[model samples]
Target: MLIKVNDRVEIIAGEYRSRPAKGADKVVQGKVLKVIPSTGKVVVEGVNKMYKHVKPSQRNPQGGRLIREAPIQMSNVMYVCNACGQRSRLGVKQLDSGVKVRFCKKCNADQGEIAPARKPAS
Candidate 1:
């Protein structure tokens, strides 16, 4: 997953693309909340919103519509490089110390490393 958690991304496609509203930039930027590589989807902050009708519960006395972010296809987003501040492609590079890291293809700057998954405990 090149676009991991906390990485800033720009919505390039889908319904969330830039639209005239009030005073807003033409390009929408947000951080990645979750990445579902299995489904090729990503939950970006403040994008692809959906409303969930909630029932009354102990936590809430009144039930109402809950707005939340919905997952968008990974192909619909592009990685925004923190280094160059531009939307760019991601690429892998290996260091002489035998460490592999993700880098911005446009600026050729190091982004970060993907941590290995932890093993399940017995």
Candidate 2:
């Protein structure tokens, strides 16, 4: 996946589309809270909110319904270009330092340095 934590994303599909009021033009832009590559999903901040019923516990003496962000399909989101300020596809380009970086396909502006690939556990 091209998205990482802290990356701004806009929901392009699903029921949560056009749900965020903080963004412009019904485009729900938010930071990526988590990325689940195993499930091909990403949890965006303030998107795909779900309510969970919980029992009273030590952690929550008055446990009731709690709203939380849920994972959404990776295909439903498009990366927001920092330069163009629009939802766009991401393109990978290698830097002179041998680091791979993500850039906006529309304006070809660098989004940010890509995180190093995760090493598989032994």
Candidate 3:
């Protein structure tokens, strides 16, 4: 998938249709936490939230609950344009280094920058 980790994307057509990951078009600013290309799903930052119960721990010591972003499928999301501020499909372009970058289809601007997945230091 062209979308990398940390890429900001939006939901296109679904119950979340027309709404970005944050429940509005303004959700583009959210970063991509994970990408599931095989399933066409992307875990957007601070979006698609779900609750989780945690066992008693030193920090909680009371087994509380927490909310987390659930994975939204790629088909349900699209890349947002920084220039036009619209959620649109992406166009692939080859750079000088032969690296393909996803571009905004609406405004034809280069957008959706993502970082390579990094491993935490041991």
Q: Please, what are the lDDT tens digits per residue for candidate 3 over residues 1-122? A: 76778766765555544453443334434678998878878888866666679999999899978777778777666766667878767787766654556688888887644433344479
lDDT of each: 0.83, 0.83, 0.69
Q: Can you list the residue pairs that collide in candidate 2?
A: none
Ranking by TM-score: 1, 2, 3
Give me candidate 3's TM-score against the actual structure. Answer: 0.64
The parts of candidate 1 lying over 4 Å away from their true place are: 18-27, 115-122
Clashes of each: 0, 0, 2
**Taking the tens digit of each residue's C-alpha lDDT, what string does model 2 give over 28-52?**
7888999999999999988877777
Which number leads on TM-score?
A: 1
Question: Judged by lDDT against the true structure, how good is candidate 2?
Answer: 0.83
lDDT of 1 at 53: 88
Stretches of candidate 2 above 4 Å error? 18-27, 115-122
Specify the poorest-scoring 10-residue window by lDDT in model 1: 18-27
Q: Which segments of candidate 3 are over 4 A away from where they belong?
A: 16-30, 112-122
